[model samples]
Target: MAISKHIIITSLFISLLLLHPLVQAIDQEMTSNNRGGSSFAPKMNCGVACEARCRLSSRQNLCKRACGTCCSRCNCVPPGTSGNQELCPCYYTMTTHGGRRKCP
Candidate 1:
């Protein structure tokens, strides 16, 4: 019983040791990615951005919801109510579950 318990602890320790380098690599990559600025992204004012994005929509509420979702994820919105997707690639590439374009 003691030997089995020792073996279990030894196995656990080895597993953690193997995982340590992988965890460190991920941490280093994230740290380097953020070295240019804050580690946490500044939150977007989705309400105002979305409001502007949706201002000219015929379906205002639906437009706001879609614009808000894209703004939240991309932290950006193209400057107008229409067709300037080149400004935000993340927002431009997003799609709905059914493969329809997601961002307004």
Candidate 2:
């Protein structure tokens, strides 16, 4: 049992060491991609963006409420009242407390 435990620890250490460079590269790429998540996207008017996004929703108020929250956080709103989440990865990934997609 001790030998197996030792082997496991050694393997885990080796794995993390080998993966360190890969982790650093990923971190660097993401940092560059969003500049540490500060002002990376162009300044946008959340009111206008959410208005456009929620314009066609049957439940306009709820749509705008959720869209407003998403816009403030992601600094983006998908064009139109429907799909196009690809334009904003952050918005695409936003979720509610219930784990459902939040943006309209």
lDDT of 2: 0.89
Query: Where does candidate 1 stray beyond 4 Å?
Result: 1-31, 35-39
TM-score of 1: 0.64
lDDT of each: 0.90, 0.89
Which lDDT tens digits does candidate 1 get at residues 55-92?
A: 98999999999998888778889998898998889999
Model 1 residue 4 lDDT score:
100
Query: Each candidate's root-mean-square deviation in Å?
Result: 7.5, 10.9
Listed per model in order, the count of residue pairs whose N, CA or C atoms clash below 3 Å is 0, 0
- Kindly report which residue stretches of model 2 are placed more than 4 angstroms away from their true locations once superposed: 1-37
Name the candidate that leads on lDDT.
1
What's the true lDDT of residue 103 in model 1?
Answer: 95
Residues 1-104 of candidate 2 have per-residue lDDT tens digits of: 99999999999999999999999999989888886557565778999988888888899999999999988888888887799998999999988889999888
